[model samples]
Target: MLTLIGGGRDRTGGRGQTAAAAIHALLREEILSLRRKPGEPIAEKDIAAAHGVSRTPVREALLRLADEGLVDIIAKSGTHVSRIPLADLPEAITIRRVLEQLAVRGAVASATGSQIIELRAILVRTAEAAEAGDTEAFHRADEAFHEAVATAGRHPGVWALVRHVKLQVDRFRRLTLPLEGRMARVVAEHEAVLAAIEARDAEAAAAAMGAHVDGLSLGLDDLKRFNPGYFLEDSARSDLKRA
Candidate 1:
């Protein structure tokens, strides 16, 4: 079961609004991080009680989540964390590849010396988190590294668009985070992109970025083999065929 617990506010400051936002952020993180499994039931009553809020706030939060496709709110039935839409993976990957590769190319052309150093710092932190087996820390650093690159490239807006579709991909990535040496490989891949960018080689940087981002092919087989229950039925079969 998922629980929401945090700073409570007084009624005067639109307590319900604050509570709803708080619940929404907590639930969103849980869904994205796979702590709240896909298709898992999310009881408004339970969450309300856990957070000492009324069902009204919980409902508001859930509706907001539904807008983001993070949850599905059925009319009569209860709400559930949205399942990974495996069929959408290919399209999502394509979008991410194009936009992120462009972002890297832009970074190579426009990034400052200070920005390059900041990216290296993020990579170092990522490596340290991976070495320590801190999955959450590694994930945060990974996201930061990409965001830094996008910012360095002067394409922060593009990064926003990338994030819109990356949520689905992220759930899948979280599932594969436990594979042996996966984090280390991720670190290596980041290093490759950083190296190309640091050397001011736009072509190499784009190629490296493309390879790193599109390398989802290698993990598809493992995901189906190891965690078959996580994917949609038809999509799972399709993924297996591709694998």
Candidate 2:
């Protein structure tokens, strides 16, 4: 079932946005965060009732989500949360890795003391989240750490571009967070990148960033085995069944 975060209340009321936009944002978050699992049905009428709005806004929100590759709308069957595109993961990870390498290199050149401090603070928060087994908090802090680095490097647009291409990767990552030692490993990787940034070594920072991003592909077969339905099956990955 599509469960709203706050008892289906209209949390966006009076936020100076249209109901469609608000609902779109809410649904997008749920989809990305894995609260709404892939292939899960999304009923328009239920969403409208949850938000106290008509079906028009719900439909509008769903259309936007479909455009973002987060929703699948069928003419006769129904709408569903789109499954993660396994084939797209490799290219998306490559793009994000390249952009983040650029970001960290730029940060090494332009990052100020305070910006570095802010990055460290975010790292600390990530570590704390990992220690507490708070996957969601760790995810947010992980994003913040990368965004801060990009901003410090004066390449905020790089982060924006990365976000656009990494949607599927993000959803895949959420699935990986609960794996044993995964969160702690991420914190360690972040430390390595931050250490290079603090040392003003552009090359090292870029290398660390690449490695960190590349690690997202690790354990893919295991994930597919555990949650087969969450990923879109690909001919190239037929071995997943054997694994």
Candidate 3:
């Protein structure tokens, strides 16, 4: 079931989840912005005050983030931002690339004309969002554009798989997000992918998708430098110990 991880079950849990989701959004934003810093202890009382929620909700929210592998919880030391493993980024990106290309091809093969039109409209909106420098809106449009493609494929499992691994790549993506001129390039890439889709060229669409992912892989130097040690074997072993 899609129960909130530790946000209880009924009343208390339900209320806590209301707070949990709010807290989760704020914490995720802070983490992605690097404002919270990795390995920093999660001070519950502080977060509670900042979020204006009871400690109960904050605790539940932390548990949910832990479940998502976004936070590390130690028995006595409490919780901290989960250190992202950079070395695995390429592999993670590789997996996403494969799935996305498959999704693109499937989407083209299965898409009705109306679906294609809808997707094309989203891409146009995405380009506008990027050009306007609305990062959040752009991200939303980007996500919608991809989800539409995946949906057109009629493969729900692709969404599940993409969601699972995308969290791992989120941090690096956040870092590169503000890079100057990045959005324009992304918009161009989207245009190329859209062109292929419009032409019903599955092979061309797949190639464009491959290049899109490869760009991320090639530009992830900051991710690698941000946390070299965490990418090591010992780090995985340590994380396993925590579990």
Candidate 4:
């Protein structure tokens, strides 16, 4: 059911890159965005046919995905989208929290009027998405809000690092967004962070950003209970509990 409709090489495929890289980018987005569900089967033959590529390129793409823990390539059983690594969430969230706090502090100090306006626009979009109860739209806006903060703070590299480290956290978050009142709460938190930024209060902005990032784990136990199949069963749960 994962269809790559157009020719394999498009915007996702950069110039001079191999077909495999393009396929990898496409599949990576699908996996990260939750369009490709956890543990769902990935048939190399189907993908090859869909993209008009050979099995070799498809295999290469999948192998790269496996390296990133986005998919599992079993010897004989076929590949599947990897389940969320529960153990990795706490560390990722902590890293994200630190990075985002720094970003917000920097933004408060250096954000231009235009940058502030852009952030405000993102906040408005987030609020509208929340009001409409559009989980997917809300999630996109939420990510954009944080990314915009980092950009306004002139720390786009920090945002890049956060993105690299927060893959599992993103998946976990997607699951949480549909929960009762979660979207509205996120909007409220973003408003608080943005308000601090608007006021040029670096400390307040940092604190607000920290609190917002920390909220990612607020209902971990409930999430685990309801979506057992989506998470890995390991010592990470105990680690998170102890933290």
Listed per model in order, the count of residue pairs whose N, CA or C atoms clash below 3 Å is 0, 0, 0, 0
Candidate 2 lDDT by residue in tens digits, 88-164 = 89999999999999999999999999999999999999999999999989999999999999999999999999999
Q: Which lDDT tens digits does candidate 3 get at residues 1-243?
A: 122233222223345346667677667767765676666778888777655557887787788888777788787677888777665777889999999999999887888888888888888888787778887777778788888888888876897798788876767665576778787787888888878887889999999988987787655665457556333323363533242
Per-residue lDDT of candidate 1, residues 72-148 (tens digit): 77666667777777788888988999999999999999999999999999999999999999999999999999999
Off by over 4 Å in 3: 1-37, 49-57, 222-243
Q: In model 4, which residue pairs have backbone atoms overlapping below 3 Å?
A: none
Model 2: how far residue 195 lies from native, Å: 0.9
Q: Which has the greatest lDDT? A: 2
Candidate 1's TM-score reads 0.87
Error of 2 at 183 (Å): 0.8
Give the poorly placed runs of model 2, Cα more than 4 Å off: 1-15, 235-243
lDDT of each: 0.83, 0.88, 0.74, 0.85
Q: What digit string (tens of lDDT, one per residue) describes model 4 on residues 1-243?
A: 344534545444367667788788889988988899888989989889987878888888888888788887776567888889877889899999999999999999989999999989998999999999998888888889999999988899999999998988888888888888888998999999999999999989999999999999977899889878888866233222100
What local lDDT score does residue 175 receive in model 2, on the 0 to 100 scale?
A: 94
Ranking of models by TM-score: 2, 4, 1, 3
